[model samples]
Structure formats: C-alpha cells, structure tokens
Target chain A: MTFSLARPSTIVEALRLLADDTEGPTAPLAGGTDLLLDLDDGRSTARRLVSLDKLPWKTLAWDGPRLNVGATLPLARLGSDATVRARLPGLSEGVDAVGSLALRHRATLGGNLGRAAPASDLLPILLAVDATVRLVGTAGRRELPVARFLRGSRQVDLAKDELIESVSIPEARLSTYVWQRVRPANDVSQVGVAVARSGSSASWRLALGGVLPVPTRIPEAEVHLTEERPRPEDVELAANAAATHARFVTDKRASEAYRRRLVATLVRRAVARAQIPPGER
Target chain B: MTSEVALTVNGAAPRRLAVPDSERLLDTLRWRLGLKGTKEGCRTGDCGACTVLVDGETTLSCLTLTHEVQDRAVTTVEGIAEDPEGRRVLAAFAAEDALQCGYCTPGFVVSLTGIRKELGASAPDSAVIEALQGNLCRCTGYLAIVRAVARIGNGNP
Candidate 1:
C-alpha cells in the first residue's frame, strides 16, 4: 500500500522534508494534479510523498530588473498578477492558457517547471523572457536558466533531493510576440511558438510539445528568420532550418509532417506579430 | 501504509480521515464521504468529468490527493444550488438545456461556477475561454453551454 505525509507551514520546513534522505524515495507534492494521477493509476515511480500544502511560498513580486515569482504561486495568480500582466504579459498569458480554472488555482509554477513537460505553457514563455529557476536543496540554493533546466520531456536539471524554490524573470526590452496553436479544447498542444525581439536583435524560442522528446529550441531557424525578415529565400531557409533542428517523433496525438508544417506557418506569423507594438492588439 | 487527511467539502467544516496513500480525492469523496454527486468518467485529468472546485477553483478530483486538500474548500456539484453565485450558473445550465448525457454536467457546472466567480464583472471573452479551457463536453459541443454561462456576467445571452 502507498502512503502520504502532510506537513504544515513554511518553505524551510517543506525543504527539510523534501531533502530528508531518511524518508526513502520521497517526492514533493505541489498541486497533486500530475503526481497524484500517476499514483492512482499505479504508474508512479514514487514511494513516499512530502506534501507542500502549507508552504509559505505563494507570492509574486517585481524588483525592477527581475520579477520574483514564488514557485508555489499558481497559474491563476500568475495570470492575474498586475506586475506580470504589465511587464511579462507573455508569461502571464502562457500561465492563463494552462489547464482549466480549477487546475490553475492549484497548479504551482514549481510543479509545472518541475514536471518539465515540453507542452508546458509557461516554459515557452519563460524561454522568451529568459527566466531563471531557483532551486532549494538541503545544502543550499542554486539557480538554473529556464532554457537549460528543462533537460527533456517531463524532466529537469533538479537533483533527486532538490526542490524548485521559485522562478525569476529578468526585465527585457519592450517587445511583442504571439502564441499561436491549433489544439483540441484542453488538449496539450500540436505546435506552440514563442518569439521575441531585443534591440535590433530578434529571437525566436519555438517549442514543439507533443511533437518531440523534449521542448526543442531551433536557434538555427531563429537566426535565419531574425537576420533576414520576410525575405522569401530567408523564410524558406529559416523554415527548413527549423524542420532540420526539430526532431519530431510521431505521437498518437499528431504527426511529424503536420508539426513541421505548423512550425513553418507559426514561425512566420510569430515574427510578423513581434514586429507590431503591444497597443495594436 | 495509511494517513489521515482533513478537508472542508462543499462549505462544511473540515472532516478528517485516514486512508491508504493510493486513494484519490474522488474515491474518498464518493466511498467515504457519500457525496455521490461528483462523478468520475475518466480517471485521468484529460476529461473534465471528475471536476470539483478546490479553494473556489475547478480541479480534477480524480487527479488530486485527499491529503493535499486539508482545510481547503471543495465545492462539488451538489453544492451548486446552495451557493447564490453558483446557483446562477446552474440555473443557466438548466434553462439552456445545456446537458444531454448529463454525465459530464456536474463537472461542467462546477467549472462554469468557478469561471463565473473568478471573472466577476469584467470577464472578457478571452478570459472566459481561458477559464473553461480544461473542460471537455461531447453533448453540447460547448456552444450552448458557453452561451448559457456567458450570459451571467454581461447579463446578455
């Protein structure tokens, strides 16, 4: 029979429980959306659970250059946070698009980041904003870039005994982008794209979820598209570069050919949208 | 092998119990609490059939832990008629004939209730879409359902 442990209050207390080696294969429980389901279905690799229910880490703050969002902050809070809505609206919009209202209220930023699903909405947005994840372990705390932290689908750079403390988004140039996708209602994603521009330098952070082994970033495509915008030759070159970099495997949800086509179409539109001002929308 | 969890279900005070770690919140609600109104169709979070309002937000009970909900408020389908705001959405669902099979109705109702409550007076069309994105309904194709719930805030159907 499986068992659960519920500890009340404080991040330090939660961290101690999470880092407890004596607990024996313990997994930290945040929203319990993904982890609990896995456990119910007998698919869980977890032996013990350290609940973060009362952890005092639910806050969203802006400190000029960086926006410090507690890992426990839920999607609803992220979507509605005035600072997020004003500064990093892309990240806010991404969080708003995740799951349903109920899930959003319960699903935490840490859980989503920890789960590290390529289909994770906030991740693609975080990549655009260049956010960093703060992970707390028994020894101390450390930071990892969002782009690098996500090692693969449902995987992260988190050590076995570490817990994600929070995610910080450093302020960037005032830029606009678009998140365009075609998916069944509440379904993960067929093709999701996030692109941005900084100074004269434009960048595209294209994430293909439910399409590849992990959220793959096509810098080659991004370079081609940003350097030579709208030129037919450049567009084709960029699209091909994206397809070359995108290692799409056929999933039950979608095909590699369909995803490739989406990448081409979405990359073009994302670039065009980024060129427009925010007020235009 | 077992642990006790305390929770507030549908406006009542917290009720405490001990169960095996493997038991889901949905199972505990039905088998233990006897609140049979919250139905379970898909054991996974994919289907909205097992939806409930946890801390006034809609979530899949089947995918939630009984222990995690300690001291949290859970609004189930049975409680919809009792809540003044929730009743409005429920009434809208009823007046529009928004349900066919009715199996997915409770989850839809709870989800809509959460949407109606969260968005309040200024919920834009996009906000409404985002709020209800997680729910899946085969009966209405969600048009009538959306139309029914959309009328609540703007007071225009």
Candidate 2:
C-alpha cells in the first residue's frame, strides 16, 4: 500500500526502473487484478510497482497462421477478437474462464503466466496450444516454450531486469478448455483440462491444470487419441491416464480425492469438446 | 510519492489533484472526490460493486490504480444518467425493482450500461444475463435482475 509507481512509456525505461533496487523490489504491474490483491493483503513483499500500462506492449498481431500477443494486451480484448475466437477456441475458453467480464477487462496474458498460479485456468490451454513466451532483459530478447518459461507458482524464468515481451502461438489448433468450479466466474477450478490438435496432425495434445507446482502435459494420455475423432474406449483410456498422471493439488478448496475424479471427468469432456467438427461445434 | 493527476469524470472538465502513488481508483472516487456512488464491497475484483467506466470500458475500480487511468474519462453510477444508454439501464432496473439490499444495484446497472455500449441495445437477453455473472445479488435471488435484463433486451427499457 506504500509503494511508488513508475509508468515508463518504453521498455528500456521500464527495465531500468525494475533493475534499480534502491527503492526495493519492483513488481511489474500488468493488469493488477491479482497483484493488487496480493500487495494489499501482505501476500506480496514488493515495495515498488512498474506499471506496464504506458509501454507499447498492448498489441496483437497475426501473421498467416501464427499469432503474437503483446504481454500487456487485456484478456477481454484477446477473448473478443474474431480471429482468436475462430482459430483458437480453447484459448478463448481459457480467457473467458479466468474471471468476470470486469476483471477480464483488465487481466492480461503476461500477468497470468507471470503469476503462474497452480489453479490458473489459462495455463492449461497455453500448454495445450504449445505457446511460446518471449522475454527481454539485459541478456537481450529470448523465446522459450511456455512449458519451460514457467518455473513454479509465483515464479517464472524472468530475472529482476527481465520483462515478458509477447507470447506467440505457432499455429491455430482445434482446442477447448473444460473445468469444474463452484461458480463459473472468479472461482478457482478443481481440475482443469485442455485438449488441442494440430490441423496437419491428428495427434492430440493434452494438459492438466489445478495441479501443484505447475500445469503440465500428459503425453501418456494423448497417445490414446489416434484418429481425428477418437473412439469412446480410447477417450476413456485417455481420461483414466490423465487422472492417474496429474499431481492434483491438496488445497482447502478441494479434496485431493475429489480433484482426481474431476480430472477424469473433465478430461473426457475436454477431449470430446476439442474433437468436435468445426461447423458442428 | 504523491503526484499531480488529471482525469475527467461525469462529463465534467478534467479534475486535477494530488494523489498518492498506491491509491486505488475506488478510494480516489469514494474519499478524494466524495463520489460514494461507486461502492466498495470487495476490495478484490470478485465483487463488481466498484465497477466504473474508464474511457468507455467497464473497469473494476478496486483492482485499478488511480494513476493507471490518468487523463481517461471515468463514469460512475453518479454519472450514469449523463449517457442515454446508462439512463435507460438505470430506469429499467428501477422499473423491474431489481434490488432489495440495493448494495449491488449500482454495479449491476453500470455493468448493464457497459454491455449496451459493447454489444449495443439489441443484444440478446441470454448474452446480457451471461454478462452479469460477475455481479452477485444475495437478495431477490436475481429474479428481478433477470427481468431488468429482459426489459433492456426488448429495447423498451
């Protein structure tokens, strides 16, 4: 509640402000929906905030099949984009599942991935779609797979002077995000499942969320999805493998046993949802 | 780190004032400007009680930093009547008697007004209802609120 805010219009100034520790650790403020709550409640120890609002990172670009989203673009803007909705349905589903319309209006993809909360609804889809995170710092700009960029909850592969520049999805996929929660909006998922398939390859990519540490892919389950449309038996096998594979979280909000059951059910539903024909869906 | 900030509110001339760096827009509206119409139910973004429009987009004032919206147009429930769409939404809520405790009414009305701006007046009733998922109404069980949304969707509110 007693931190100085720095709104640098350029990336260099923002990095310099973040690197200057004389004022104490500066947390980058993307949308501030989660960070503000953490700072106000003493959960975060940041003594300074570098607002990304002024930076020219609120961009969304599509080059052919690849889509690049600037780190500060709001989740609402991403979800409302017609091409994003059409090409990456699962990503849209994940964006919509984050919070209410008001909250989504301010939440950003960079903030979501930077926080890397275990129960984040966005990560599963990001992993399913094989998104890549681009970062810039004293070491210069580097790109890493989202699977490698995330270290742990409240942890990322970002240095003190580093900033997330953009996230790139290599190509669009047939994908969907499915989860169960007490409430549809602003509630953490008990178990989140995302399934995606490349246009060229019928092989499905699967990821499980609401797990401890980080959301991860389940290659063991994906093998069961052999055809464009998987059979009921293979889907059941895939779901069972998914449930058995994920490291479900043991938070007070959900029982570990219940989470396992939800994972299996959600995995089945997500696979079915992802494999639906485009026009039929 | 107090700084001089300037922003427009309620269709008025830009108000320039000194504000603390960590001040939230919700606090600035309630305490600094005395615009108590924007209630603070949850300091977090879960409750939409602090909903307002920043540059014509629905925003959660609780999660938004005052400095983040510098020089932007802000419209609160106090200024809801200034816009024709907002006025219609407010009148519809009153006609439907959409509130009991009334604590959540302002947020619902503001959110509906924002929906009108985003989706236009002819947006479907289902879409408007889905958009209200952010708002919580302990009293009236959302029956009256649904009626209000229905009235707006009918383009008669």
Error of 2 at A206 (Å): 0.4
Give the clashing pairs for model 2: none
Q: Write the per-residue lDDT of candidate 1 for residues B29-70, one digit (tens) a residue.
A: 899989888888877677788888887877788878777777
Each candidate structure's TM-score, on Cα atoms with residue i matched to residue i, is 0.89, 0.98
Fnat across every predicted model, in order: 0.76, 0.86
> Which parts of model 2 have CA positions greater than 4 angstroms off?
A200-202, A277-280
The weakest ten consecutive residues by lDDT in model 1 chain A span A172-181
CA shift of A167, model 1, Å: 0.8
Q: After superposition, how far is residue B29 of candidate 2 from its true place, in Å?
A: 0.3
DockQ of the two-chain complex in candidate 1? 0.61
**Candidate 1 residue lDDT tens string, A1-281:** 37556564876677666666574677888877777777766767677787776776787888866889888877778877766555665666577567666777778888988887756666766776667899887778999888899887787898766788889986543433343345645666666666644343454444444445566567787666555245777767776777667877666656788777777776666666655544454
Best by lDDT: 2
Q: Which CAPRI level is candidate 2?
A: high
In DockQ terms, which candidate is top?
A: 2
